[model samples]
Target: MDLTINDRVLVVFAEKAELPVAELDLDQTFEEIGLDSLHLMEVALWVQKEYGAVIPEGDLHHEQTVREALAYLDARTR
Candidate 1:
């Protein structure tokens, strides 16, 4: 599914982790989604696949918010 930044994060929370997007809080740490380090990698992989863009290796761990992740991608896509 084509998604905005918020949408992408929510989809990762939902589709991959089986959480409901509506239940996610924007300010909540992604930890609240219960992802471990491996899941973080999965999210990164999914993001890359969905966007057809590889997020830099380090940024995946650095970005703590959907908006920030999107900004990272936006900067790269330019």
Candidate 2:
């Protein structure tokens, strides 16, 4: 099965956060999932490696929800 961009992003975040993908909610902020700046940076690096997209530093913040972050990355990937 082909995973959509949202699914791929959720998988990355879930893996980094040490949580099950089923537990990740799109509306939940990164803070809510216990992901800090370091984790976000790691995720950004992963995105860079996986998609060749350079996510802006400002976009990786605690206030950004999973869905919003996915959208930002998805936009750049396309």
Candidate 3:
């Protein structure tokens, strides 16, 4: 999906991440940014509040990287 200006997924991801927003190259994969599982959970919680959806605990547990977590959120949002 094309990221909307106020896309909460991107918002929370960017806010919690250590990198500057301008540096989050869209061409790069989320894994390349190096956010750990704990931070992923922080993003997930933000997703839940922002999008108002439930992310399954099982899937969240197995999501080992940022890319995987993005895919999980994408599926949930759609």
Best by TM-score: 2
lDDT of 2 by residue, 1-78 (tens): 999877888898999889999999889999999999999999888888988989878778999999899888889889
TM-score of each predicted structure versus truth: 0.64, 0.90, 0.58
lDDT, candidates in the order shown? 0.61, 0.90, 0.59
lDDT of 1 by residue, 1-78 (tens): 655665555677666556777776555545665655677778777767766767655665523654555456566544
Question: Residue-wise lDDT of candidate 3 within 1-78, one digit each (tens)?
Answer: 777423555556566666766666544544566655676667666667867777755455432454455666777876
List the pairs of residues colliding in candidate 2.
none
Best by lDDT: 2
Clashing pairs in 3: none
Order of models, best TM-score first: 2, 1, 3
Q: Which stretches of candidate 1 lie over 4 Å from their true place?
A: 1-5, 62-78
Better of 1 and 2 by lDDT: 2
**Candidate 2: stretches off by over 4 Å:** none
Which candidate do you rate higher for TM-score, 1 or 2? 2
Q: Evaluate model 1: give its lDDT.
A: 0.61
